[model samples]
Every structure is written in structure tokens, then in C-alpha cells.
Target: MRKLTDFISESFIWSVGITRPKPGQERLAALYITATLAASILAAMTMFLLVLHRL
Candidate 1:
């Protein structure tokens, strides 16, 4: 379980093309990724609703 979380966070950081954070900073990196994903999803939903209302 622990290793899985580490791998996921590391993969996220790598995919984002950012430098590997220090050991203590992994949590913050994960939080930043989560916030970014959430914001993108929210923006897409808002845009979809606006377009749907035009019909």
C-alpha cells in the first residue's frame, strides 16, 4: 500500500515534467496535482453547461 502511493506520486510528478521534490515535499506535490485536476474538471463542466444552454 505504501509503495503504491509513492509510485503514484512519483509518476504524477514525472508526468508533470517538474523536478523531483524532496522526500518531505511529496505530499505537497500530490496536493498540488489534485488541486490542478480538480480545477480542470470544474472548468470543463462549467463550459459544457454553458454550451448546452445555447441549444
Candidate 2:
């Protein structure tokens, strides 16, 4: 959990363009965050739909 929280914080920082990220690093970090968010949302939606279908 702590590691997850740390990754999220770092991703947020990179996305916000707050810190002086190294060349190409910022884009990679931002992409990582965006992908993570998209995957999470998709997984949640799938689970919700499955539950609804089961009911």
C-alpha cells in the first residue's frame, strides 16, 4: 500500500509538471499515470457490469 501511494504521488507530480524531471522522464511518468488510470477505470467498469449482470 505504501509503495502504491508513493507511485501515485510521484505520478501526480510528474503529471502536474511540478518538479524538474529529466528529459523524456516526464513524458514516461505521465504516460504511466494515464495508463494506470485508464486501466483502473476499465477494470472497475467491467466489475460493475459483471455484478449487475449477475443480479
Give the top-scoring candidate (TM-score). Answer: 1
Best by lDDT: 1
TM-score of each: 0.63, 0.60
What would the per-residue lDDT of candidate 1 be over residues 1-55, giving only the tens digit for each residue?
A: 4555566667777787778877798777666666677688999999999999986
- In angstroms, the error of model 1 at 31 is 0.7
Candidate 2 residue-wise lDDT at 30:
55
Clashes in model 1: which pairs?
A: none
lDDT of 2 by residue, 7-35 (tens): 77476776776665577575565566657
